[model samples]
Target: MRSGLLVSGRRGGSGRVVGMLHLRVVCPVDATDEVLAVLKAHPGVTHVALFPGAAIEPAGDVVAADLAREATDEVLSALCGLGIDHTGGVTLEQIDTALSDAADRAEEAAPGEAADAVVWEELLSRTGEESRLNATFLAFLTIACLLAAVGVVTNSPVTIVGAMVVGPEFGPLAAIAVGIVLRRWDLVRRAGLALAVGFPLAMLVTFGGAVLGSYSGLFDRTMVLSAHQVDFVFQVGPFSLIVALLAGAAGMLSMTSAKSAALVGVFISVTTVPAAGYAAIAAVLGEWAICGMSVLQLVVNLVGIVVAAAVVLALRNRRSRTRDLGRPLSNG
Candidate 1:
């Protein structure tokens, strides 16, 4: 049975009206088409996705009647006509309650927690069905990490930032966190393996490049210990952890949100690669202090990303549960 439904609406106002409507309906897959047809008839509905067993919950703030009465009435009439039950009134509280309920059920149907860690595996399973594990992705990762290492060695903020924009490691890490929470061993294994294998390889390759640069006169003592304007260094306080935490959260949001993936690149810029490059440079120079700082930076980023992803997924799950509790009608 389908576990949730989401319906959304918008209203026009005297000045400029911005309205959003979302609904969650729980029904079996066989009945989904009928339910979808009914929902499609509602006005001002922009997007609707159907996940048969996914979690759905009510979302958004309650709209004030003074603001959305006309649009609200039009939506109410349409819903009643289709035999799709919905609460009336344009109060913001009511709207929030309604949408939240729908979203909860949607989440219950397909929990993402267990699947989080195995993101690569899941991606492979999904895309591999259509195409082979393209070498392009791996190559890109390697190149990006190498560039970031170079950026650190040169103390070039621009190069390091560029490398961050190119790094694609966050997705796999997020998957691992999700896998860990959901106790999905497969996902955990895939994510863990990717991290274990990919991380060291990236570090090693980048280190080799740094060594070559040292031999080639590209690296110097000042560059080795110098922290870029964009790089986070050791002897640092809590701020590094905060940045990592926020970046981690944003990364997860980008992954789950269809329209928000664009922000993921920025998130990457704030984490991981720059620190990696710094570590490689420190190692090549035998700068213990700098190496320690770089290692701390890396650890901070890794922990922040993992913790943030896990917490965000867990919160989403809880909200979905709340919506399920509030939904009154049974989806047949």
Candidate 2:
């Protein structure tokens, strides 16, 4: 491990807490010195510990350190350039609390505050998990849409809100943007599959449910058409686009910042689930025009989100790269 001036940071005036990351690196014996050199050269790294030949499986040395969150992307990139990511192992964990003046000074030395920093590698890993097409993703989406259909039929905003909060569509959506920004077509295709395959399947399931409910007399066309409170799901308009754009930006930002609370707001703000529900129910009642409009609303929201999120990630990537050019990171 490289040892030197450990950087630390302070909170913003609004009580935004500073961020720290615990990084663990395992590398072959021959690469140990260069890895140490990189850590030693970084101002934002601190509390580095080196254990020679501690790695059993990979059979290498272990290097661990604390870093101001701002420096994580840079340091990881340099290490990857050394091919440690492929040859050995790299892991990261969040540090909730740190009590050291040197750590604070390390943050001060870092280029940016924690809230503003975009750790590309971290974002990619996190979103990569979210974008994977799995049973859980399909299940949640289907359940959320079903809940939303119930909410729409009953004209209950509360139920609709619950449905929105339950939906997991944002994960794949944000992953698409992240993939686009990083030029990871595999990530892009995987996320695209999650969205493309997931949404239609979920909506189809909801449509079947709506049909069953209609036969059982759970809801009829009159009640569905009478639903005014939650009609916003199919109310395609400029504001729909606006809300989607804002929500998409917030959703992507929440992923980068790790502000999960912001995610709840993002989830409730967009109408993806509700729109899908509305479309399914409308189709059951033979309300083709309304169904068409609801599908349009869904498309508008999805497109708006993708566009806004892509722009945000692109700009952040640009800013990070520009910083790299002006002040090159110590790659060792």
Candidate 3:
């Protein structure tokens, strides 16, 4: 498989494959007709091609096509029901840029605008992996809190924003919402474990460093009391909940549409990491009231995001007739 860098050169100017998927299939020779029929039946799929006897391992025919992002789950469902996954293989890749009129028409032919389409399968897979309680997740969350700690002490908005971007908490938070929408209780439990264990652990680690720094004359109570921006991090109010709700909605939209920039904005918009950091820092300084407030802030943001994201996903689910999508597999 080519790395993402290698695919960058294929970005033609005429059309953007922003909301499309590239599907490659290896199947037994006899199944080529069935695969073609499935691809052709979808109004949102295009650029279908078949190469006979192209597989070296499975030693069968190869079928390739481009599909609208919205149609991905439906097509995959149809294909999977054919038992292609067991006898053959399938691969789906993001098409960053496709400079073809056929691609444009393909998007236009779909149920909704490419940008508004929700590829639930892709979203679930991506978020599910991220929601793992792994060392990498812990590392990013710790680093973010550590950065937030420094930002709180020094009163640096830039550092705070950097911490927000570095934080990986959004993954599990998003996974929780997605899981709820899909009624995937296992996903919810796993993601809940990640958040349940990841945050306090990161905060505990940050708290130790904060205490060590304080004893070494690196921090003081004055720093906590005088900082302006950290004030926002530690304060809980109606607007805090409001901003979180807005960010959560925007974040879900970005996830569904695969919008990178908007996702970044969601990262910066929430104060989860910063609140965790501030709470730890305040605790180290013996400001129990401030620490409690920061913890409350953290809770508000987390709950608001989860509730808001679940709503967005639930609505999208109601709008989609996922089970009835695509044509039934041919018996021939």
Winner on TM-score between 1 and 2 is 2
Minimal lDDT window, size 10, model 2? 1-10
- What are the runs in model 3 whose C-alpha is more than 4 Å off? 1-18, 57-59, 322-332
> Distance (Å) between predicted and true CA of 257, model 1?
2.9
**Which 10 consecutive residues of model 3 have the lowest summed lDDT?**
1-10
lDDT of 1 by residue, 1-332 (tens): 11222333423312211222234444444445655554454322324556554422332222211112112233343334434343221111112222332233333332233222122222333322322223554555567778877776666777877888887667567766667656666766766666666656777888898888888998687765555464464444588788877877776655543224556554454657667767777788888777778778777888888898778767755654564365332222
Of the candidates shown, which would achieve the greatest lDDT relative to the real structure?
2
Query: lDDT of each model, Cα atoms only?
Result: 0.54, 0.87, 0.86
Preferred candidate (lDDT higher): 1 or 3? 3
TM-score of each: 0.59, 0.93, 0.90
- Give residue 282's lDDT in candidate 2 (0 to 100): 93
